[model samples]
Target: MTDIHIQPRPVVHQLRAFTPDLPDRTVGELRRLLGLDEVIKLSFNESPYGPSPRVVAALQQAARYVNFYYDPEGRELRDKLAAHYGVGSDYIFLANGADEAITLIAQAYLAPGDEAVIPALTFGTCAFATRLVGAQPVFVPVRQDLAIDLAAMAQAVTPRTKLVYLCNPNNPTGIMIDGSELRRFVAGLPQHIIVLIDEAYAEFVTDPAYLSGMALMPNHANIVTVRTFSKIYGMAALRLGYGIARPELVAMINRVRNPFNVNFLAHVAALAALADTDFHRLVAARNAEQRQRLTEAFTERGWQVCPSQTNFLFADTGQDSAAFCLALARRGIIIRPGHGWQLPSFVRITVGSPEQNDKLLAALRELNGQ
Candidate 1:
C-alpha cells in the first residue's frame, strides 16, 4: 500500500460562507420513510396535466438523435420561441433551465462587493446566486398586502448595486406588477443596472392585470426576461428554458455559458412542445380554475389568501409552519414551509390536480378542526 494520497485544497471563504437551504430528501423518499400509501405534492409548481402528447411522440422520435451532439446554438428552439414573440433569434439565449440563466447572469455581470436587489420572500435562487458571486443581496420586504414593495426596493438600490431581480407573478407570493408599473420601474432605474425578470411560472398566470416582463425586451436593453418549460409544459425532468435580452446582453451571458448547454432530447422535445397549442391552452385554463377554487377555499375558512396571478397560493398560515408541514407530511401531502424565508405565519402550496387539491383540503379540514 503506497501512501500516495493527494490533499484537497480548502474552499474559498465565500464558498465556505454559502449555506444550503433545501429539503434533505424528495417527496417520494419521504413518503417511503413515513409509510404513507400516497403523497400529494403541492410544493414545487409542476403541471398536473403533463406536456402535450405530441411532446411524448416527439421524444420517442428524437430517441435516435440521442447519439448526436445538441445544436451548440440551440437554434431550432430559439427560432420557435422567437417566432412566438415575433422577435429575432439574436435576442434569445437557452439554458438547462431558467435556474442556470440566473447563475449565468451572476457570472457575467457580478463582481465582488456588487449588490443585487431582490423582493423579500421571493425565490431563493436570485439571492443565492448573488452570494455565489461574492456579491450582496439586499432584500426589500413585501408590503402588508404580501406584494412586492417597489418603492422600498428602489430606495434599497445604491452605487454598489449591479442587478435587480423581479419575479413576475413572484414565486411564493404570486403577486405581480402590471406592465405600466414595471415599465415605470425600469424607466426610473439607473441606466447601468440590469433587471433580471424570472418568469418561470408566467404561463400559469390567469389574472388579466398581470403582465409578462417579456414586453420590455428589445425596447429596454437592460431588461432580461427568463422563462422555462418546467412549469405549464410539464418538462421539468428535461431541463429547458431561455433568456430574452438585448443581443449584446445575450452575447455577454453566452460568454460564460457553456457551448451546447441544453441536451439533445431536451432540445428536440422543447421544439415539439411549443407546437402543441391546444395542450398549452388546456393547462392554462385548468390552472386558472384550480387557482380560484383553492383561494376561495382558504378564504372561507378565515385564512387570508394573497391575491395570486400564478398557479400557486400564499397564505398567512397563522402558526408554526414547520410543525404544520410535518403534520401534513405524515398524512402524505407535501407543502412548502415559509418561515425559513422569514415569513413565519405563511405557507406556499401549488395548484395541483383537482383530486389532489381535494385531498389537501380534506386533510386541512381535519387539522383545522372545521
Candidate 2:
C-alpha cells in the first residue's frame, strides 16, 4: 500500500475583513422562507413591469444562436446603444450589469490605499467595488435635502483620491445633484481623478434640471457615464448594462471586462428593449403616477418621504428602520431597511403597480395601527 501524504493548506489573509457585510437580499429569500407563492417585491428597485413584448420576441428569435459563441466586442449591441445615445460605437462598453461595470471601473483604475469619494447615502455596491480593489472609500455625507454635498465632495478630494462616484437621483435618498452644481464641481476637479456618474434611474426622472452624464462625457476625458437596462427597460433578469466614455477610457474598461461578459440573450433583449419606445413611454408614465401616489400615501401616514426623481421612495420611518422592515415583513410586506447605507431611520420602497402600492400603504398603516 502506498502512503498518502496531506499537503498543508496555504495561509491566506481574510479579504472579507476589510469589506462591509452586506445583508442578504432579504426580499427574495424571505419569500422562499415563508413559502409564499406570490410575493409583492417592492424591496429591490426592479421595474414592476416586465420586458416589452418585442423584447420577448427578439429573445425567442435569438434562441437559435445559443449553440454559437457571442461577439466578444458586443458590436451589435454597442452600435444600437450608440445610435440611441448619439455616440460612436467605440465610446460604449457593454457589461453583464451595471454592477459588473462598476467592478471593471474599479479594476481599471483603483489601487491599494487610493481613495474613492462617494456620497454616504448612495448605493452600497460602489463602496464594495472600491474595497474589492483594495481602495479606501471616503464617504461625503449628503446635504440636509439628502442630495450629494458637492462642495463637501470637492473638499473630500485629496492627493490619494482616484475616483469619484456620483449616483444621480442618488439611490436610497432619491435626490439628484443639480446640473450646474455637478458641472462646476467636475470642472474644478483635478484631471487625474475620474468621475463615475451612475445614471441608472435617469429615464424615470421628470426634472428638466436633472442632466444626463452623457452630456458631460464628450468634453471630460475623466468622466464615465453608466446606464442599466434593469431599471426602465424591465430587464433586470437579463442583466444588461453599458457605459459611455471617451474611446480611450472605454478601451481600458473593455480590456478589464471578460470577453463574453454579456450573454447572447441579454444582447438581443437589450437591443429590442431599446427599440421599444412605446413600452418606454408607458413605463415612464406609470412610474410617474405611482411615484406621486406612493408619496401621498406616505405623507398621509405621517412618514417623511424624500423628494424622489427615481422610481423609488425613501421614507424616514421615524423609528428603527431595521425593526420596521421586520414588522412589515411579518405582515407580508417587504421594504429595504436603510441601515446598510448608514441611515437607521429610513426605508427605500420601489414604486410598484397601483395594486401593489395600495397593499404597501395598507401594510404600513396596519403596522402603525393608524
Query: All models: lDDT?
Result: 0.85, 0.86
Question: Where does candidate 1 have its weakest 10-residue lDDT segment?
Answer: 9-18
- lDDT by residue for model 1 over 1-370, one digit each (tens)? 9997775433134454434333335666767778877887788787778788999999998898787887799888889999998889988999989899998999999988899999886888888788877889998988888778888889999999999999987888888777778888888898789999999888877667666677776467798999999999999889988998888999999999998889989988898888988999998998999999999998987778988888889898778888888888878888888877677778889899899999999999888783
TM-score per candidate, in order? 0.93, 0.91
Error of 2 at 362 (Å): 2.2
> How many clashes (backbone atoms < 3 Å, residues ≥3 apart in a chain or on different chains) does model 1 have?
0
Report the backbone clash tally of model 2.
0
TM for candidate 1 is 0.93
lDDT of 2 by residue, 1-370 (tens): 9887865322122133433222244556666765665567777788888899999999999999899998889999899889988999999998888988888999999988899999887887778888777788999988887878999999999999999999998887788778888898899999889899999999999988888778887667899998999999999988888899999999898889999999999998998988899999999999999999989888887889999999999988789988888777776777788877778998889999888888887887787784
lDDT of 1: 0.85
lDDT for 309 (candidate 1): 82
Candidate 2: residue 292 lDDT (0-100): 94
